[model samples]
Target: MKPSIPYLLAYAFTLASRRADEELREHGLTVRQFGLLMQLRLEPELTMAELARQLGISRQSLHEMVGELEQAGHLRREPGATGRTLRLTLVPGTARLLFDAHGPLMRAEEDFLRGMGKREIETLRVLLQRVLAHATDDEAWLA
Candidate 1:
């Protein structure tokens, strides 16, 4: 029997995330933590809510991740410009981790799509974005 679309995508994502997670763990980071670092790197000084929104995760979950990261000395916490908001400062440790993991991460992604042709992957990206757009549109209408 053929698996449903969501089931197949979930399976693929789980396997890919596990691979990336293993690579990142060697550097003392989880995939979610790496996502936080990526967010900070891309949009400096994002508040916890903003970070959660950007990552499509809960603020409470992000808060827990931040606590863990700060404890690990990978990040420094600072007060945001606005009232009671929290900001994350990337420590040198995180920068080093991200830099060192670059090759492995890239190779992991390459290995993931090795089974699929480039054109196929590109088409998949377009289709996925269309699906996401419709979902977000429905959400906006509901709001």
Candidate 2:
């Protein structure tokens, strides 16, 4: 019997995450750390609460991850410009690490979708975007 769509999605997600994690680990980064960095890069000076909301994680959990990243010199947190919230800023060298990881990450994703044609890939992207948009009212996820 064929697997259900949800099961298939879960399996694919697990494999993709594992592979991406392995690739990122080679450069001293984890998938979660990379995601945090990417999010910060996209929106500089994002506050802890906003970031936690965007990431769908608890503020305390995000705080711990921020601490680890700060200790590793990948990012820093400072007082927000307009509020008491702490804003996250990526360190100067973070771009280099992100650049280094991009190739492998893209390759991993491409390999995962190896057999899909261009149109199929485009359709998949659209569907995923729709799902995400529907699941989260926050427009930041679309960005």
Model 2: CA > 4 A from native: 1-8, 140-143
Among these predictions, the greatest TM-score belongs to 2
Error of 2 at 8 (Å): 4.7
Model 1 stretches astray by more than 4 angstroms: 1-5, 125-143
TM-score of 1: 0.77
Tens digits of per-residue lDDT for model 1, 1-143:
98899899889879988888887777888777887887687678678777787677888898889899889898888878875776789987677777787777777777878898889988876776676557555332222
Each model's Cα RMSD: 4.6, 2.5
Candidate 1: worst-modelled 10 consecutive residues by lDDT: 134-143
Q: Write the per-residue lDDT of candidate 2 for residues 1-143, one digit (tens) a residue.
A: 98897898779889887888887888777777888899899888667887887777898889898999999999987888876667788889899999999988887778778999999988888877776676667555455
lDDT of the candidates, in the order given: 0.78, 0.82
